[model samples]
Target: MCPPEHFTVEYAINPWMDTKIAVDGALALKQWASLRDTLTDLGHLVHVLDARPGLPDMVYSANGAFSVDGTVYGARFKYPQRAGEADEHRAFYAEKTDNWRFFAPEQVNEGEGDFTYLPGAYGGIVLAGYGFRTDPAAHAEAQEILGRPVISLKLVDPAFYHLDTALAVLDDRHVTYYPEAFSPASQRVLAQLFPDALLADRSDAEAFGLNLVSDGRHVILNTEATAMGHKVRAAGYLPVHVNLSELKLGGGSVKCAVAELRP
Candidate 1:
């Protein structure tokens, strides 16, 4: 995880960002540190990525790249503001990891932000979100590069720009997401794919409840998602709350701060 030492909402890419509200840098750092520590305390190996001086949004490491089975598909950012991050992430993986094959696709894609793996009986299914930051064409590229079946899901909500912000993979068969964020066709596809998935209400979704990460048991989510927390607990998962209000200023939360290396 990269510290939010340089995090600020200087530009508005998503609806959540408001440049008028001054972000408390110190508080952001504290919250980020707490999140990192919490993940480590949960017995997960946390790796620190050095944050660049100018790339403020680099703290949202999940957008950097998508790693699966030792192969890293470097991100091709849609916005110029975050374009430089792709190279930095590629270099890091190249220099730090051993035997890691990297694929740099020309099409626009926001790495893990749009690409999420669904593990189950139909394991290795990649749910790729598009119509926002990611281009729909990249789904085929991802399938070819990763050698996995890709299901294209069209995102319709600006607030849920990335799939991670709208959908949370809780376990093999279950997922939690805001139905309105996706297109009607995509919603039908999701229902067919995950019939028993938990559906979050508008209030919970506005609180960024679906922007979570789970270890199949413990779910880490935004503190404001109280109702969603109760729902998660009822679904047999421990909901761990973390206050990332400052980070929310950048249209990101718990899942955005993390980049999983799936091996």
Candidate 2:
């Protein structure tokens, strides 16, 4: 059978969010609205995962899981509270598609948050970032399961819990990231791979909502990231920013909201 078509989206549900992880609920909801509006404007097919009772904190889905090829793989978060989330996603994927898998119950891995794909980078190599929610052992498992090389990198900051939070590669040569979020080795690797990358300074990165989506030339970001927004525009890209401060409380932005379906 052929693999199913792919598309990315974010869910609006919250309350499942850990209070420790999210400082304020009211602010996060506002951010979610901004992110939602932006995705809708961009012609993305936003699929809203049904809200589960007692799972009020479900808005942190950027860490939930992601799809690779035709198979759906759920992430194993380092946080114990999030372990049950994998089961929830497994059920969601099973209902949506037949191809479903996990990172071995014992292994740990968060999907899009820690994992990303760059089609032009080494025949579409998949880079899985570790040192945050995803464990190193899980990265190896992902490599074996996906049948592609999964490069691992350690994220340097706690605030940037996942790779996507601090760095997102928009295309093969261009990347959106905050340099402070990367370790020395990871920085070097990033430099070697994306020689023409657009690295944003801390203030601009935070203001621009750095980890957003890019369909090659068009980048979707938060309007709040003004400086970064201007830089992206200068780089010959159409930068679309929506307000997603509410969603930020759940610890993700536009990148976490939408999944991309590749041909």
Q: Please, what is the whole-model Cα lDDT of each candidate in the order they appear? A: 0.90, 0.66
Candidate 2 minimal-lDDT segment of 10 residues = 1-10
Candidate 2: tens digits of C-alpha lDDT, residues 1-263: 00011111222222223444534445555556566666667676666665454444455566667666765556776766556666766666667554555433357877677888776777768777877678888777777777677877788777777788778877764677777888899888877877888888878655536777887777888777878778888988888877766555555667776555431
Residue 157 local lDDT, model 1? 85
In model 1, which regions exceed 4 Å deviation?
A: none
Candidate 1 has which clashing residue pairs, if any? Answer: none
TM-score of each candidate?
0.97, 0.82
lDDT of 1: 0.90
TM-score result, candidate 2? 0.82
User: What ranges in model 2 sit over 4 Å off?
Assistant: 1-34, 98-105, 261-263
When summed lDDT is taken over every stretch of 10 residues in candidate 1, the lowest stretch is 116-125
